[model samples]
Target: MAGTSKPAVYKYSRGAQPGTAARTGDWRFLTPNWIYRPSPCRIACPLGSEIPAWLEAVKRERFDEAWRILRRSNPFPAISGAVCFHPCTENCNRGQLDESIAIPELERAVGEWRQKHYRPPAGPPVTRGRVAVIGSGPAGLSCAYYLNRAGIGVTVFERAPVCGGLLALGIPQYRLPRALLSRELEMLKDDGIIFETGVAAGGELPLDRLNEEYDLLFLAVGAQKERPLNIPGAEAAGVISAYEFLRRVNLGETVRLVEPVIVVGGGNAAVDAARVALLQEGITRVSLVYRRTRKEMPATADEVDAAEKEGVQLYFNLSPQALRLEEERPAEILFEQTETAEGKIKVLPAPPRSFACGTLIYALGQQPDWEALGRLSRELTLFAGGDLVSGPSTVPAAIQAGRLAAAGIMERLKRRPGTGEAQFLEGKPVVGFEELNLAALPSAHLTRRLSDPVAEAGRCIGCGTCSSCGLCALYCPDLAVQWRRERYDVNLDYCKGCGLCARECPARALVMKGGWEDAC
Candidate 1:
């Protein structure tokens, strides 16, 4: 009787019964997870640029689409490509293979190419509201761009004769061309963005009046107030702030200086000032002093390298204590030896040393003029960003802050907001160097091109995303893996949960988990 007992059989149907599926583990089967993890370069960007997406588009020879995608996050790609510190390149995964893609140069090339064919998009049809923006710096301009594109009229007021605040007067021509800056600003102007140059927001147009006139207000006055060295002899004849020096030089003013000029601080401004000092007629040498070592300096590595190449003597682990003046003119400076210990500044007991120099240019830092905002009246919806809110930062950071402010304003205006995030993965398992299966990738595709952007994009690791390399299906020992409709599917009838597919995944996008099934 026991040997003759009937064998039970179950037929699967797409019905409501949970335990009546063809495969015993239909609902509780192990799934091969595929996700697009955030690339390190994209994560490093302040503007949240979809770096990999554009890079892929470039690889496919979709230049216009790539340009459009790039512009979605960054408005001034050409300007940014020229001046950005490019932290993205530093975080590039391709560097592990051979050399990091020349992201900045590629961006510059594509950006300039797009600039030749750029046309301002048609303004939004519905008139939602009007807004007032103070300052025409990167932050203000970016804020106005977003607002104007959203069918909101933006009136930008700049105190300078030209619209670009720092881009026009702070950055030198050799680094950022004025013609290029002017041309990019023209795009914003053509978009119906009102630019009122030579008009100070809190001066010609009072804050109270602006509040009453516009429904919303954004203040991005920037850190125009240069922080000065709090030491004696700073008021000497040749002792001047770096901002004033750079501004005057950038405005085409003739600046004549004596030999051996000293520029204090290690930030970007300090490096720029030192380089500018070397260009003066009588300046034979430029000396730059910083409290920290070269590793801890805040300026970009390329800037420091360029300054060194341009004959700027760098003195690190030295802090300026005082300036010495001879007959009311800068002649020497005093410095204190310092070191960073346990993340704290430690000034040693060594005696202060003196160095001889004709002029002193101090660029310690800059502070925003918060008082310029006046009282925050409850009657007005006020917002601020860039250096005004976050202190001194980079141009891309300012642009990102401006975008955030625009979204906040749009929400207040009862309008829908745009997706400010990049098209990348989040919270996925990060593939490490050891986890990568590089043998599946061809060695020829690993070496990228320097001059070719499309070729350069091929070197990307495509972290946490399937590259469809066929390694998973090809290496499946059980013959359970099947490729159908551009995706891999595992036949549970033959699969033994061996996890060979997950191990052989080049992108590390697949993972095997514990699974359960109801056996009838």
Candidate 2:
């Protein structure tokens, strides 16, 4: 014991000592900053919905708050939830781990919740500006909703007897239920948005009257002019465009279909037409012929799968040459076998083959009828969006266009010169899976339409969003991270520029920047 120098006693400083008293933040070239970057799902979403925020609310069982947050950007969540391709799910960071968080299902749950519990708000008085929206498609309705919410007097003119253009006339009831669409439209009406049905913009109501009557005009006349089937006998009595066919079917018109129905093209409309034909009475066989293979199909994989499941036969790499007609109706169709090479379709050298066809529906696509808009004077303030501007796009893209047009109109009304585009996430960096701390997250697989929405929502790791999990504070070796004023704050006086907090952050909300100056 005498020689052992009994355990050297080291006095502990109560607070900072010598070197620790100095601002350690100044000692390093890099600093940790809290910043919000667009998640890959948010970036890929055309409507730009704040998905993580609403998902957080959903997981917490705050359904009302989630619905409110969702409706801020998207007006018709119910409709979009059912019909949107849900590109957000495909780009979800969680998918890199195990499975995507079933975004569309959660979105639909939120939407359906709103539909069940929705109460009409007191109509906001029309106090700002007057806007005339031509067409009642997603774009037109979205523009009208935003404008009305801004206290602008908005009137939607629809050529169809019903208000919803594509929703009512293009998409079948199986995808977007008519009852849901009607309820959503009723809610919009109760909020004081006016809808005038059976009024054609360029036909009955002239563009000149709209320009003179309203402060601004928003045109969302969706792409309605079908691209014709240029083949011989395309004008046969049994041959029809897919748009016309779907429109007639959706409008409750009696559709008489013959057996061995053939639908040409590789898009959603083509698939819809074939499926609809299969459902018709007296129709046993419905075949879909596409010039390209299934991999090259523009239709969503789910729809294609559903078509196959519903007994619609699919024939790929067949290009229709001509329809052989009997009594001015399609009897047999001749096709040229083809192959895709370097993104181009090359006809095979084999002899042309023919298939018996009782009817032919061509879903080649549609174009915007711009004849009336061409006559309007450029002097008038006109904002055009949706399929009218970008032909044959998805519902969410059309909604985005409408939102942008509304913003532009609002700017013009406020006498400010600006493009109508939403600039919030323009320059923000999109967060990738590599930037996330996946090690901190547990692996889980969420199925679509899971009975427990909360459980499904809980799977989301809140990529690129701060959840204030206190991991930063917990992992900081220097005790420099502090939770203050509802957010995490770093005490630069004690922070030594260590990257531990950033590395421990599960949300990728904290990043180490190159300079001591805050880059957030």
Candidate 3:
């Protein structure tokens, strides 16, 4: 008994060898295919930013990692945070639970935090052939940013004295401060992007001449030309296009205005013009006139609300008829009552109502200056994007266009036929409110004031992605699920496909897949 080790008494009976399934038919059922799906927010973004990835990084207190993830797709998060329509929030899966995540505010926080703390070390000189981008707006800047990062030399040409085409000239300072905009633009300068202000490509500089100097030409010339108002008294001294007025104001020129300013149209430009008019010293009682109802207005609801809060009177369903002039300035404007019936605008044939105004600003819309682009050169590789191609879209869309143009240029210059679509594993099903076990989650209504990053990051549900919570491992029926490094993996030999691991997963990141043979 002393030498035999007491026959190693067993406490429990053992089953067939633990890993024996590797050689038998049981392997088919035990094998599982893991997948990673794009969050709804990521799919909605035209820039293809990995929203969930960065959010997870933020939750882990990896602020720099989050910023790096953001920089992978969006070049100007600070600018976008101020101006982007933020379609990502609308598409967020969290909306089904309580409220959509405050994506734009968080993005702004990350951008501001990164700007204050992280400055990328200067990159080496570009060895790839020189690329010329015309226009210093979102599209051109985005294109140049990506190209420069890729070691491609980029020279941005602008006709204005300053950069940021619409960003500098079209947007109001109250919405996007010029100092913040300039600081964001300085990042471009620090990255070694060549700037040729007061130089107009395709016209003053000549596209043919540029072709000899640069290997590629990207025409990002955005739509800055104001769409003319066809109504009477458009040429009146007091009536000015909103684009021109905003441009003059943004460029730091003195705009002498009279009281009772009237802004026409129902777009962001109109709302912006109204707000700016309210801030002017001589202006009082700003009125916004639109033919459509509040619900149909093109401007963002928040912007409209801001304008109203700033004492701008909104007159919906009012169509401009004629402008009465006194001493070559607008004195009064005639309007007609309008209503939408069967999806068509019907102007009622009633006695025209008249409203008096000291000044009039028409914020109708804008179109690209095709003449600036001139005729397309047959001999040169030409790429056009941004508002020039999309016709006055949102800033994010314009940025996306620039990214696409950069990709095209990269493909052409590299002489690659085309890179195939990126391969990705299928993601798990989107987690719904009903599927979530709320007991383990933070309050669905949990949100922070936009300034608080830690509190805001806490509200994230980590939808459709693993938060590495270890709940799956804790609940695995057969001890098949194990944590290694930072991720959980299944030991298929011990797995019986009971699906408890996936069922208990808090983030809905795991899914029970049919075996390889069964899938076939």
Top-TM-score candidate index: 3
Q: After superposition, how far is residue 154 of candidate 1 from its true place, in Å?
A: 1.3
| Model 3, CA-based lDDT | 0.78
lDDT of 2 at 318: 94
lDDT tens per residue, model 2, 1-520: 6685788788786665566666666666678898877888888899988888788788878899888778767877788889999999999988878788788888888988988998877645565678989899999999888887777889999989998999999998899999999988998888888899998876787767887888888989899988999999998788889999999999999877776899999999999888888878888799999999999999999999999999999999999998889988889999999999988999999888898999899999889977856766676678999999999999999988888888889888883422232335768888888878866654234444478888888887778876555678888988888877656888887878888989988889888988767634
Q: Return the TM-score for candidate 1, rounded to 2 decimals.
A: 0.82
**Better structure of 1 and 3 per lDDT:** 3
Query: TM-score of each candidate?
Result: 0.82, 0.87, 0.88
Q: Against the unseen true structure, what C-alpha lDDT does each candidate score?
A: 0.77, 0.85, 0.78
Q: Which ten contiguous residues of candidate 2 have the minimum total lDDT?
A: 415-424
User: Model 1 over residues 171-224: C-alpha lDDT tens digits?
Assistant: 777778887788888878888888898877768877688877899989888898
Model 3 TM-score, all chains together? 0.88
